[model samples]
Target: MNKIIWLFPFVLSTLYVSAQKKTDRKTLSNLQMHVAYLASDKLEGRRTGTPGEQLAAAYIAGQMKDIGLTPMGEEGFLQTFTVKEGREPAADTKMSIGDQILTPGTQFIPLPFSAASSAKGEVIPNVNEPDNIWLVNVSEMDITNPHESMANQYLKEAKEAQQAGATAVVFYNSKETAAEVAEWLDQNPAPIPVPAVWVNDAVSKKLMADDAEGFKINLQVAFKPTKRTGTNVIGYIDNKAEKTIILGAHYDHLGYGEDHNGLGTATKEIYNGADDNASGTAALLEIARLLKASKLRGNNYAIVAFSGEELGLFGSKYFTEHSQIALSQANFMINMDMVGRLTAEKGLQIGGIGTSPAWNTILPAVAPKELKLSYDSAGVGPSDHTSFYRKNIPVLFFFTGTHSDYHKPTDDAGKLNYDGALSVVKLVYDIIDKANGMDKLTFSKTREPQMGTNARFSVTLGIMPDYTFDKGGVRIDGVTDGRPASKAGMAAGDVIVQMGSLPVTNLEAYMQALGTFKKGDQTDVKVKRGNAEKVFQVQF
Candidate 1:
């Protein structure tokens, strides 16, 4: 009887220990496999539509199949879509102002959003006209400093000029304002209603100084829009529940060190976004494995590996718009982004806590002692979760926060905290457990955070500034196709060393430099293309 009792406990303990070792091995091995492959050099940073991205999609789809999850995408496990990637200037372009012939890429740049058409007419300052080209001088406006709201005004005025029957609009402003206008153009895929040009202060003054009467302007610009393909891998675990839970992670990263590479380093080097997404992606796969193996399948699970997220939630937005499974049945969504870098102290940052009343309550209860939860109420941030939140669906975003290696070639798999990632996966599993089979979560709208603003000013630089650049100077990730920066031949990867007479050492300095200019002003912008320094004149 004593042997029976002793041996029974020993046998049970041995089996439990063996099972634990097996689990530990599986967890680490599975996570490592996913992150290693997804963030490996062979994947080539997995930019949307690229061969690397296709490979990633195939791998994810294969994994979904292995998990016994049914395909929840348009085609098997893939939901393919086309998006306007970017636009390039087409030939047959011309611009002239009376006797002065404006050279393309030197005197004026066409905004990417500008329509491909020809327009010629007398130039008049802020005059609403159908046949006349309107001249907008920033000096004439109430702009006194750099401000985010003022940046919108530039686009608003451009739309107004188009609506007022103006054939084109010419803006004269400071380098800062021109940068802002350029940025706005690059961001909005919609074409501008009319031709637009941003001339330097010198050009503005020269034009304004001349007689308004018989002042003719002629311009022609053609933009060739580029299309890029991306895929969203979706798999479903249906428990016949009316309300479903969604788990998502972006698998795309900056490809071949494009303009979006925050550090502005390495033009062609692969940016293997290991922690930026590979970690999150790995977590998703691990969670799926757990869910598949678990007995508790309370609610339906729709797990997605989104693509084109680096470009702006393209996959998530597309999935939400054309979901194979009705999004109306989605109770809530959990997004894992940049969750690979979780530290013992920093733990995890859970954004979108205010997105549902249930999150704040359920999070603490489910979170383990190992994790310290930092909460953020705002649902709208720079990730795919924002796409679902916009659809009135509650969301929870898991992140480990930014790191020194963010958006750079240095974000490789070797640097990921695998153990931390596994914990996050467990946390997600618990979160699902807490909400599964429950009544649909009440979606609450949280106020959106300020869009790209750290300082208030009147003037703006028109290019989309890469905020994550770890180096000196403000890095320009994207230039509006037809705005001042584009006209000035300034492009992505150009580091704005100086704007006008002020040094732009960082984003704050860049903003400070912008506040010094008003409308109808012009300034010289110095940029470092590589080791070479180049100067371009920008008008606001």
Candidate 2:
């Protein structure tokens, strides 16, 4: 998730500035050089699991090696993880009714939950004969219930057919209806026992036209699993201390806007996320250099360049779960993201202030007078810092704010504020230095904020949707107090399966369900908690 901070203007007292320091020429040059290469078109926006992301990881590793930081990853400085990149139809996937061959993607399409096997038998329309293909017609089904899922309906029908010893199940609509078969094609569900497929309206009409007699059908539903590997670069300055401080930044960006997460999705343009994260990664590199050469050795330092942050904090989450370093010895974590576009006001947004009491004292003392800082007390937000906060660790997230060029091709290296970024690096270093004298900071739980305010919807469930959940439905990461979700007893980790009369299949479906309601509306929200499904009455 992107760090979409909703800025509220605030400033620190000028008394905090004890002295003014000159900007180092070498630091500025290094920041610019790092951003220039990482955000350049040559890196293709450094999308995770791509060659571009690998190149960026290699470069960060090289920089860490040059700084003399000890490699801390499972493989030298690289920690790799596998990501499920959806699925694709195999070459053998085909369907035919006697001599009439049907196209795979157009005339007929296999659902993601279809069994990867072949089935052949005689088919009779609207017949549930044993050892025969079942042709289920959904033309007369009551699909008007908003809470009902067409995909689920198809799966239920297929399951019933399989129970009757059917060879396979095929779904189609004989008449015009609002329901679409294509909508069920992309859903991720558990595979059924037998092959299942959906045919387009043209093929459906052809099948129903010949329902008077049985026909031999040959069907195959085969899919190849699509996957990619994301790598995290880890380097440690082992001061031989009892505690370790972590510094992290994500280097992945939207590659040619292929993931549909970018602002400019209509064009095949490389979304060079300079301000989005390249700037933060550059700052991390410079910070590693400073810490490696610093005399403050009260705590060990772990510098990490994470990937797949734009894809729901995959890299950081993976590291925290499968860390080589002792997490129990972790002091705190500082995350830098989108720290390149500092305004003339020197505005900087810092989150997770409420995560630790030490931040309340250390931040104001070490902050420079030139910088106008706004703070969010929430320990959970749309960034990698939230991952650490979840583990009962203190966290701080630094960001300059969003811009018009955010998540677009226009966000290039030339637009970065090198001097401003360098200042941010210095401020982080100062905070670390001030905290060197203290013991590990105490962790505190704070309220989680909503992801963002979307203009498309007027009402909100007041929950942060977990973006990493791919199994189906929208999983709640956090629930805001005094909101609809909280009032209805919705808690974090609860997967919302239905909203009112609408079935919530995915994040987009959940958002659409939100748009259907208004203030003062009351509805029943169904969520899956553990092995049980519960319904809560919510008033919006």
Give the alpha-carbon lDDT of every model: 0.80, 0.83
Give TM per candidate: 0.65, 0.70
Error of 2 at 453 (Å): 19
Error of 2 at 406 (Å): 2.7
Worst 10 residues of 2 by lDDT: 6-15
**Residue-by-residue lDDT tens digits, candidate 1, 342-455:** 777666888899999988778888989867777778788789999999999999999886765776778888898888887888889888887765678999999764325554
Alpha carbon lDDT at 167, candidate 1: 82
- Give per-model CA RMSD: 10.4, 12.0
Q: Compose the digit string of candidate 2's lDDT tens values, residues 127-149.
A: 66888788888765555554445
Question: In order, how many clashes per candidate?
Answer: 37, 2
